[model samples]
Target: MPETGSGRRTLPTVADTEAFGRELAADLRPGDLVILDGPLGAGKTALTRGIAAGLGVQGRVSSPTFIIARQHRAGDHPGAIPMVHVDAYRLGGDLDELDALDLDTDLNHAVVVVEWGLGVVEHLTDRHLRIQLHREPESDVRTIVWEWIS
Candidate 1:
């Protein structure tokens, strides 16, 4: 069962993180927004890889830090869901700059996942699912916490 209040997941390994992502993906739908916040090396991308796998998206899923964003098209298959993965680590101080990214265009048919978007991107919509990852020091364990916002 999902943890009360926070819906937390204690992921001890890379595979566990991915599995959590996939489990979350099962409930995602078009136009849904998932915001992720965590320090470097917190397994955000690893978790996203699992989400993509759950969505039935083909191709490699990696951090798009350089490109800003990457779209994974859902192939012709049952239960396929498109994914728009974005890295907001490079954006400037202005939230207005996010408008240029054009993420809203396809959001209606895909799940938009934003990394490091704690403050800038949440204003895009009133309803969203936010995930935070915290890595344990001196250990590979990571804690994942998620909650719904409206």
Candidate 2:
């Protein structure tokens, strides 16, 4: 298993952001929880898309804003893990609503990723990867800072 660490990156394009996510996924496991904090247009969904690709999960990864969550099954690769992508913006900090989704249960079988989940999802796990994305003013560039918190 990879040790806990933190780092920052400047992504020049959407592809760069996704590539970074793919790299991050290399250290993830089935029970990992990843919280993404960012404003609108920060490429959170794109990063999740990359993570899905890296994990070899089946499905076209997309924002779960409307549905709140989406589960992607593992692919054919040995030891492949599934992914549960979530958009928590609509939850409005309601823990009950969050709990209704039973994400903690999914964590045991999939990598649970929550967007807009800084304060809301941390309690679901003892340790988690927190990633903050910042989009430059009036530009497509993005800066991402992340760390594994325990």
User: Pick by lDDT: which candidate is best?
Assistant: 2
Error of 1 at 19 (Å): 0.6
Tens-digit per-residue lDDT, 30-127, candidate 2:
89999999999999998999888888899899999999999999999896789999999999999999999999999989999999999999999999
- 9, model 2: CA deviation in Å? 0.7
Q: What is the Cα-based lDDT of residue 37 in candidate 2?
A: 96
Please write out the lDDT profile of model 1 over residues 37-145, one tens digit for every residue.
9999999999999889988887899999999899999968998999999999998545667898887776878999999888878877768888999999987799998
Alpha carbon lDDT of residue 113, candidate 2? Answer: 93
Query: Alpha-carbon error at 59 in model 2, in Å?
Result: 0.6
Give each model's whole-structure lDDT.
0.87, 0.92
| Candidate 1 structure lDDT | 0.87
Model 2, position 83, has a per-residue lDDT of 96
Each model's TM-score, in the order given? 0.93, 0.96
